[model samples]
Target: MTAAFAATPAFAKDVIVQMKNQGAASAMVFEPSFVQAMPGDTVKFVPTDKSHSAQTIPSMLPAGVAPVIGKMNQEMSIKVDKPGLYGVACKPHTSMGMVALIQVGKGPSANLATARAVKLPPLAAKRMNPMLAKAR
Candidate 1:
């Protein structure tokens, strides 16, 4: 883990959402369901492939919020001082179950809402799939 990962505040720890060579579909869903963070937490989405990206959209987020695009492995930071669920996903693989759930607080239920899971366009898999495998 890098200093940034460890330096994550007690309330929030740096979480890594890693993409796999299995293809864009694999990158879509994080093996672990819930990524925990605090008020000022930073999460890094390390795309195995350069084409992959982690983006947030208002439609995807809770009400009264706008989506922010965080480039893969770009070291984006998030502050959830208030209480709510944040939704995230991969643009290329949204069609193929590539969704992430971020819980920003410690309490009863995170109550994070689910985002639309999309299936990887067959061609998208063909284009981005091998790029990741070669990286490994």
Candidate 2:
């Protein structure tokens, strides 16, 4: 193992998901709503505006995994340790569809059905369906 032939992905990744808010709260969104990473990667949720926080949809997480919930305007980071589809949403603006998805590795998701069955706001549903499709 020489420096010239190093395996870059062997290292952990730190990614940022920005919560963007337009003039009004109803226009809030997550910039770059879809993210992909490998195990050990950490996704950082940053509030780019006001009144927004990142939290995982429990049913969307892999078995034995816990959900992540962040405070408004405060950043949150979650280490990726499994292969599955993870959903994130801004609780306050859920109706505006402030949602995102994280795809970890290339394995088939183990909780897609439960994730889909989880209750979602109308706008969140509109925003998350396509993302769930591509993730699976």
Best candidate, TM-score-wise? Answer: 2
Cα lDDT over the full model 2: 0.83
What's the CA RMSD for each of the models? 9.7, 3.9
* Tens digit of per-residue lDDT, candidate 1, span 1-136: 6887766665545677765435433444543434666567776666654555677534434455556787754534445444445556567666665555565556332333223332335644443343222221
Candidate 1: 10-residue stretch with minimal lDDT:
127-136
List TM-scores for all candidates, in order: 0.57, 0.85
**Which candidate wins on lDDT?**
2
C-alpha RMSD of candidate 2: 3.9
Off by over 4 Å in 1: 1-12, 23-27, 31-33, 62-65, 72-77, 107-136
Clash pairs of candidate 2? none
Q: In every candidate, how many clashes are there? A: 9, 0
**Residues 63-88 of candidate 2: C-alpha lDDT, one tens digit per residue:** 88899999988998888888787889
